[model samples]
Target: MTDLLTIRGVSKRFPGVQVLTGVDFDLRPGEVHALMGENGAGKSTLMKILAGLQPADEGQILHRGEEIALRSPLDARERGILLIHQELSLSPELSAAENIYLGAWPTNGIGLLRKSELNRRAGEALKALGCDVGPKTRIGGLSIARKQMVEIARIHAFKANVVILDEPTASLTDAERDQLFATIRDLKARGVGIIYISHKMDEIFTITDRITVLRDGVVQGTLATGETDADRVTQMMIGRKLDAFFSRAEEKFGAEVLRVEGLGRRGDYHDVSFRVRQGEVLGLYGLIGAGRSEVVETLFGIRRPDRGKLWWQGRETAFPSPRQAIDMGLCLAPENRKEQGLVLGLGGRDNIALPSLRVFSTFGVMRHAREQAVYLTYRDLLQIKTTGPATALRTLSGGNQQKFVLAKWLCRKPKLLVLDEPTRGIDVGSKAAIHALIAKLAEDGLAVIVISSEMPEVLGVSHRILTMADGRLTGEFSGAAMTEENLIRAVAHHAA
Candidate 1:
């Protein structure tokens, strides 16, 4: 397998930020090469350069052994290159077939768009991508995994020799991820060169042949996958060794703090029953669309449950909105952390204190110094990397922004905490810190519920794990028995 793509002396810079500099990279035919880095490590920048999403400040690109200047994705396509972005690009109203064969449509004998030809090619492309979505089904109704498959199918339909998947499995379930990996393998077998960008060390080691690490706008190093472990990769990305990231903290149980019975939301989930005692961490594990989020949302009053009874500290209650839920000492950190977690344009301190602004208000006058003090506490506590409490949330890294969101919730000092996909986009170091913080909170007698798609996460932090499939509680796994294989089997057998 010769080099199918090569980047030499690449560099990029924004107004106040120099994102990438003097980067070198190459991709061989029939290989799954991974890109690794922390959130601000220039991985996205380099990928944008390769995909023509952004032009290089100074560099030369060689595709298929020929020097080329790609000004747009269409130009890159002419060079047989395809990019599946971390943020998906699919029309929600369009059908899978329409999305796949969008511009280059095959026509019928009558010179009109051929429906049969569209479905046939779309179906074949989806099959090769290991996706089972219906060709004619509307894209909006499909799961995130299936939508990602649609994107991959569209790229595969182009028959590009060089394919780039940027964090493609970030939102997918384990089984769905395996299906994606299988598709990558098939592509490699068919002589397509692949660039896989991810922060997940396990997946990279398992699937990729080689890896390139970027840090602070420079190439850290490239290493063979067989020659490194998670620890080494972590060191390479950060230029230092990290400590242990998980701890099975001793949890103390108190009286039931949260109880739900016959919880049912119309067209969502039904008859969900659970209780979380003070100092308890309840792990909710489910594949995408498995109602894990719906159950929590109902608890948080994001949606009205069709039928159910909820008790806070054994007192029957009903919340019609998140405001009511917050008043009752409950908080939810939603899935799209960037979108729902923080106000991007606001200062980090302001975002952190926004949830409980009234607390920092004196006689209807806002106390700026008070909010600053609170932000400084969490800024040091979470080790958030920013200029100061006054820095805009958008200027911070993804992990730091997440910490700010958590800080906002912490300012409220809620009795019941609901973290949905809390560690979704964070790196290993931040993940460890967050998990440890969750455990510490639980030990202090705050009832906690963690809704996650990550198997290891559910197994790691929860004393009791509830498995959801579709919109129902299918099974419950105990603290000691929640292995990866069992969890996979449970999800597979019960997933809707």
Candidate 2:
């Protein structure tokens, strides 16, 4: 069979890095080919070359056995090649139908907009993808999963020949992911070629026909999906066996670090009671909109509880603001790291110092040497890969960016840490590293709380697990009680 798209000997070079060295990849009609790698393994560089976001230093690209030059995104789109980025790109103020047909809206004889026809066509497109999001609904009002559905709907409407999906299910729930897989199968039936990039082993094995691994800016190897397993693929990507992707040290619990009794926030959560002890890692598991984040935000003083009491170090207290909570030795790594945790426009050193300026500043003057030393210390500790301390945070990979967020808070040396979805959108190696880091923090007698949607993650790093549903603490499990079956049942206990 003829290849739909072929990349031969592709190489890309930045100022001080050879991102891709003689990389070769291909996609065929009616196939889902997976691209797997650790963060900074040259996956994004290669994808950008394919999407015409950047030019390859050395390579040959062929479409239908004919050589081609893709100099811009428009050029790639002209050839029916579309890329759906992990970060959504849609106008929040516009309706779903308008965003779907932004560049090519339906028109009448005089080029006036045909609003009804546009909505109808967009609705049909969304229906084809098994999404029921209202066509006229504003994009800003939709959930992340629904916005993703709208992105996929645009591609379906365009009838793209070759589609590149980057971390497509990073924010989706199980049900939404099933709907996406159905859409993919439908696209395959129509002979659309797909290049799927994800860190999830199950997702890769489930949907991909072939797997290609990239490591240190070079092609490791490609294997037929049916002929290999995750262990082999992970080994290829990281050059080592991850015998235990998650681990925790044996540590004795100390005094209770925090205690919440009958916490309630109007229209958010109510009667949420939990406690975390020193040298303990508590895992909070819940589906989206289950009010997990809301509960944590309240603890960190981002939200005030209308009812209930909080006790820190056995003393009942109230934090009226985040600064007060921080002063009291509490820190939170928010769920949306990109928007809330770190400033992408700043350099790594500046971001790491943003929250702990007092530690680096003396008598109202910035202490550059102390700040630089701290940045280097945490950079080595977290294994943050970057060109220099001055490198923009935005240029770093998702894993490294997340690590910086951790470094920022860890520098504060807080007594308790709240991590919301700590490993979202990062590679497997980074996930394991972060999990180990969490365990290490707990070993040092710091109370840690991890909020995650991934079941395996919640089960692995957490010493004790708490489940939430519809803003209520449904169940708590420890030791023998911590099983997937019980956790699943608890998460749905109060679902409406």
Candidate 3:
């Protein structure tokens, strides 16, 4: 197989940061090349250069043995290159056909719309990926998986030779991910080169033909997927052996801080009963749609439980809103961090201080000195990489953004903390850091409840694990009983 694209000596520098340095990468026709790296490791920079979203300060991009200058996104697209970002760029109000042919809609003479031709062309593209969705269906009504397929269909419509999929399976279910893998195989059969960027080790090993590791704005090495293991790849990306990535410290739990009895929220969850102790790390594990989040939301007062009782510090209580929960020394870090957890346009100091502003305020005026002191404390503790405290939260990488979210709640000094998918979309190093932080917080006598879909995360950080299924607590395991097989069985077992 001949090389379809070759990148040599790629270097990019921002105002205050050097992104990529002397990087060399290549791709062959019909091959899935995996780009592996931690947050801020120049993977995104290299891909942006390839997609023409950004220019390399010094490098040469060769396509089909000919050097090409991709000065703009349109220039790259004209040469058969397409980049599908992690966040899908589909218009919600438009139908599948309209979105696929957005700027290039077929028009009759005199600028008249040719609806039939648009649908036919869109349908042909979708069918090529084994998708049966009607072209007239609205994009917003489609699942995340289907939306991704539509994006791939657009690539096919453009006759793209090189496709870049950034974190394609980040929000997909197991079955939907399998469908996407099938689609990728089809695209491979048609000789399309795929540049896959992901933090997921399993997906990379499963779908990619080769893996390229990048760290600290430089290339670590590129290895054949069949010849490498996850540990080796991880070591290359982080520059250290992660033998104890999931290690947990011994903990001695204190008195019960929270107790729930017959917690039921109409259609959401029912008969949920659990006890969280001080200095305890409780892990909640279950398949998606198993009411793990709903239970936490109800506990945090996001939803009212029609028939239930909560005992806070051994006293019966009710939280009608999140403010009430926060007042009662309980806080929740939601799963969807972008939408619910952090204010993107705001700076790190503003976000971390938002929840605990009262502490840094006098006579309804914020004390800038106090706020800065607190912000600087957490910035160092969490190792958040940012230009400054005033830098926009959106500018931080996923891992750093997550750390700021944790800092926001940690500043409040909550008695009980609920973390939902705390490590989702973060790199391996960040995941380990968050896991260690969770264990440390628990060891410091803070009651913590972790809700995660990753088995290793739950097993490694939690002193005990609780399994939920169909809106109810099904099983509890600890110590030697918290194996992956046991957890899966507990989640899979359906109760009458």
Candidate 4:
């Protein structure tokens, strides 16, 4: 079959960064081609050029063997190209049908709204995707998974020939992800070429026919999926093979630092209990809506618990607010880092110092030198990549952004640290670094609780593992009992 789209000699540059360098790629009809790379490896830059969100400094694009210029997003869309961003792009206040037919809603003879026709077409699109979401339901009221389905249905309704999916499964449950895979197969059968961009090795291998690797704004190589294994692709992505990526020497545990009993929040979680000790890493494993994050948020006092008891530092305590929890040496690096953890407009120095301003100030006066010193300390320790401390947090890649979030809390020297999905959208290289960091933090006698959707990650980093299902603790494992099989089984144990 002839290639559907071709990109040759593509390159891009910013003020002080060369984002892409002479990148060459192509896509064939009916193919799921994966674009794999580290956080700053130029994947997003290339995607932006294709979507006409930005112009390439130097490159040539061709469609059906004829040169083409995509000067705007409309040009790309007119050519049957669409992009689904990692951060969804649907209006919250609008209903599902309205979002699907947002710009080009059906109209009558005098430009009157044709609500029935719009709903009928939207219902067919949703039905084709096997989604039961109500056509008139508000987008804000729907789950993340359902919102994604609506996005896909929008693309389907447009009959897009080329689709770019960036980190599509980052927030989906296993069942939802399976349904998405089925949809992808259907699209592939219909000859819709897909540019799949993700950091997940499993998804890439499972769905893609070809794998392409980029490193530091350059194309490394492309390989047929059936002929290449994950280890080889990973080695190409990071310039080296990862051996025992989660290997660590076991450490001895200290005295208990945190304990929760009969924790409950109506409609969120119930009867959840667990304990964390000094110098111990406790792993929490569950599906997306399995109450893992809700339990942690309650523990950090983000939400009031209906019934529960918490013991901190051997004293029965209640944290009615996050400030009280932080004052008690309990801190959390939340799940959604951009919205909940960091201030994007602020510089690295400011974000790192935001939570610890009290320590650096005296008599209501600022101490720039002390703040800089602390920022530099954690920046170097975490290996955060940036031009300087004054660089905006949004300018950094996902891995470095995550490292900064860790720095923001690590400088406070909290007694018990809670991490929710620490490596959710980062690359394999960054994941290994975080796994190592978790082990080192435990060795230094800090109590840590790691909550992850990936079972391998939980098993690799934790000294003990706890599984939750339907808002309750289902199983606990340690030593020889911690296995993927057992974790999967426990995660499926729903409440009766």
Q: Please name the candidate that would achieve the greatest TM-score relative to the true structure.
A: 2
**TM-score for each predicted model, relative to the true structure:** 0.87, 0.97, 0.93, 0.96
- List, residue by residue over 1-496, the lDDT tens digit for candidate 1: 5589999999888767788889999999999999888777888777777777788999899987789988987788778888887767788898999888766678877879888889989988987777879889899898767788788886678889998898888888777888888888888998999999887778899999999988888998899999888888898887778775665558679999899899998789989998999888899997888898888888887788889898889999875488888888899998877667788888888898787878999998999989888988988988887776666777666777788888899889899999998887677777888899999998888889998887778788888888887788877777567777667667666422
Q: For candidate 1, give the lDDT.
A: 0.84
Ten residues in a row with the worst lDDT in model 1? 487-496
Score each candidate by Cα lDDT.
Answer: 0.84, 0.91, 0.88, 0.89
Model 2 lDDT tens row, 232-307: 9999999999988997756679999999999999999989899999999999999988899999899888888899
Model 4 error, position 212 (Å): 0.7
Sorting all predicted structures by TM-score, with the top scorer first, yields 2, 4, 3, 1
lDDT of 3 by residue, 1-496 (tens): 5589999999999879888899999999999999989988988788889988898999899997799999888898888888987767799899999998777899988998899999999999888766768899999998666787787688778888999999887766677678789978988999999999999898898999999999989999999999999999999999999867875656788889999999888777878899999999999999777789999998888887889888999999865588888988899999879878999999999999898878889999999999999999999999999989889887678899999999999988899999999988889999999988988888889999999988888998998899988887878998888898888888887321
For all candidates, the clash counts are: 0, 0, 0, 0
Clashing pairs in 1: none
TM-score of 4: 0.96
Worst 10 residues of 3 by lDDT: 487-496
Arranged by lDDT with the best first, the candidates are: 2, 4, 3, 1
Q: What does candidate 4's lDDT look like per residue over 110-169, in tens digits?
A: 999899999899999899888889788899998877888888887777888999999989
- Which of 1 and 3 is ahead in TM-score? 3
